[model samples]
Target: MIVQFKDVKDLTSSPAKSEKIHVYKSGENKGKTRKLNAKPARTGILPVSEKTVWTWVREGKFPKPFKMNGRTVWRLSDVETWIAEQESKATILKEGA
Candidate 1:
């Protein structure tokens, strides 16, 4: 006869954070951590062409997408921040830049 026991600490421990989870956890979500499955972002909510997205990324005007399993993807938070930045920059340019 044999007895097996599981480590009790393992049951109480927090799950390890993935990159997406970490980003959401680091005060990025108004201090709320979102699910890791939260959709990655597209430049336009209306299906933007790849060239536009890549152009901003290349120009350092957009958050660089991450390589995931051979596919490039950007986090929702990053894309949102980039959009806000672009809007602000556009306003500043119109004013004087």
Candidate 2:
């Protein structure tokens, strides 16, 4: 099944589950079977609330997100660099203190 998120509500919600997903041990699809409880991957982006992220963006505290095919998204490398810079800043503050 394919899912397309038109808005935040769609993105945050999960689809209905299906029973008995087929599995394979060898090359062919003839072995064991299990349920595949698929979950959306949330990586690279900050763990804070969406509101907080928007606030940070407005405050110029976080890297600006760009539009990709009309969908707003941030670059993984940019977020990683921001996180590293924040960690280094924290370390320097700790040392100074």
Candidate 3:
């Protein structure tokens, strides 16, 4: 499922640390439910390196990170949505070809 950024931002704007975010899993665990984290776990899921992630963020291909207690964190939902979008585009291209 693709999580909207506005929804994520609204949820994070509050002081509720216990609030859990829903993220869609891919691969063997596809369609499974998972708890979201603000930690940088993009590389584990995405095929790109840490530097590429930062580059994508700078180029507007990726979502901008949120600041949490002096630590830069990305909403897991946003990352998942971005990944889904990329995969969808790839599928479209392959189909067209």
Best by lDDT: 3
In order of appearance, the predictions have TM-scores of 0.44, 0.54, 0.55
- Candidate 3 global TM-score: 0.55
Global lDDT scores for all candidate models: 0.52, 0.63, 0.64
Q: What is the lDDT of residue 60 in candidate 2?
A: 99
The C-alpha RMSD of each candidate to the native structure, in angstroms, is: 20.5, 13.2, 15.4
For model 2, the superposed segments whose C-alpha errors exceed 4 Å read 1-45
The number of the candidate with the highest TM-score is 3
User: Candidate 1 at residue 13, lDDT?
Assistant: 28
| lDDT tens digits by residue: candidate 2, 2-29 | 4222222222233345555867777665
lDDT of 1 by residue, 1-97 (tens): 4432222121122324444653344544666654565443323342444565567669986667666676556666555566688789899999994
At residue 15, give the lDDT of candidate 1.
29
- Residue-level lDDT tens digits of model 3 in 1-97: 7543332232232222454667566677778777765543221555555676678879999889877776677777778788889999999999999
The candidates, ranked best first by TM-score, are 3, 2, 1
lDDT of 1: 0.52
2 versus 3: better lDDT goes to = 3
**Candidate 3 wrong stretches, greater than 4 Å:** 1-43
Per model, how many backbone clashes are there?
0, 0, 0
